[model samples]
Target: MCIVKKFYVADSHFGHERIIEMCARPFSSVDEMDETLIANWNAVVGDDDIVYHLGDFAMNLADEDRVRAIFNWLRGRKFLILGNHDYKRVNQLHPTLARLEWMATPTTSLETTDGGHRVYLSHYAHRTWPGQHKGAFHFYGHSHGNCPPIGRSRDVGVDLPDVAFRPRTFDELTKGMIE
Candidate 1:
């Protein structure tokens, strides 16, 4: 039997050079940022783990090949909720990025294996979502820690304030919110 761990993260911006300055990331360079992110992610996530990436996986990429390498470097079974940059921000999926197996385009929802808690995943924040009134949890990226989470929602973006720039468990993300 295998116990699969699940983690969530977003807005990694792997190939984006200016994101380090724009998001005030701690790294001095894009390579350092990417390497650190990859290292942090693999430190917690395992090959059999599942990772829910809310969006903005990469930016300013010359090609998807680099993104592919990042993907290969990380350890996990990855899923994506397309963010503006993940699909090139033109309101359409980039031709090159279309080849990756994101498992879903647009948005998706799932019930946690442990508690059967419903989690709504999206690239952009939502004022209201399906099952919102019924206590469904929402996870999203794109604000880079600007927008605060309302109710059971949270921003899992890499640049979220006070975060360690890595994938985190649902419990870790929602630690103080549940009470």
Candidate 2:
């Protein structure tokens, strides 16, 4: 039997160097930002897991081949959820990218396992969106300006000073937030 390992990936925003600086304005130096992002990704991701890229994988695909080649080198089964910036060029290499609208709020149920479904992946938070769905934890990245809101069953993955919060695991996410 094939055992499946699970992992979560999000907005890498690769290629643009000094993204921390560039986001303040625009890229200036020739430094390769994607390389650092890739390294950070590899540091956390394991070989036997899946990576879910939320969106904004890069500023532009001027170097599509190099970007895709690096992504292909990463360790994991990558699933791309199209974000606002994801254009046709980026999709060319990662053809399996999924439409964000199709994903159910709370979480997307891939298997028929008994317990509650976990980790709703999205590019942005849906404070109103998930409230309507049944109980399921959601994970999303976007609004880097805001911190991960502690909801009953939700975790935001954007790392910002004001929004800097501990990322929840599948179990913690599904179980709900602590009061």
Candidate 3:
């Protein structure tokens, strides 16, 4: 049996000082927020684990170094689902691009078996995603937890309480969504 562990997170918005004030993040400075986010992510994600970052990994398109640094600091094998803010900026640095396993479009279907469950991943939550009615669980990050839950679909954004400002395992997310 192939056993794979999957985790999900989104909208980190690293390096965006305005995000701290905008999101009411509990950090006094951008550096503090960045360190805390990196630490929190590394705490739960292991080296071999897989993480699907839904979108908005960082701000400041000009700061490619900061973006690459943040990517290197994070644990797990990373995959990205491009968000609104990620379009042009993410392509600026090809040097660190190899760190990611793959970069997907805003909406993509991920067919993987983790603990015998099928999962669908996207940047925005969908009311009716492919294979959703057939027991496929959908995970998304956009809307920042403001949107209501849709059937088996749940916002896996780090901004939400269920995720606790960190990447969450598939089992952890599913349990939170069911409750």
Measured against the true structure, the TM-scores of the candidates, in listed sequence, are: 0.90, 0.63, 0.85
The C-alpha local distance difference test score for the whole of candidate 3 amounts to 0.76
Question: Tens-digit lDDT track for model 3 on 1-179?
Answer: 53447788888988889988887888999999999999999998888888888877778756777788888889888887766667654444333333444544333335555566677777778888777777888888778778887888888887898787899888888884554
Count of backbone clashes, every candidate in sequence: 0, 4, 0
**Candidate 2 displacement at residue 117 in angstroms:** 3.4
RMSD, one per candidate, in order = 2.1, 6.4, 3.4
List per-prediction Cα lDDT, in the order shown: 0.79, 0.49, 0.76
- Ten-residue stretch with the least lDDT total in model 1: 106-115
Clashing pairs in 2: 15-34, 120-138, 120-139, 147-163
Q: Model 3 reaches what TM-score against the true structure?
A: 0.85
What would the per-residue lDDT of candidate 1 be over residues 1-179, giving only the tens digit for each residue?
A: 87888898888888889998888898888899999999999999988988988777887655778877787888988887777786554666665556666555534344343247677888778888778788778888889998988898888898876458999888888787666
Q: Candidate 2 has what TM-score?
A: 0.63
Off by over 4 Å in 3: 1-4, 89-109, 176-179
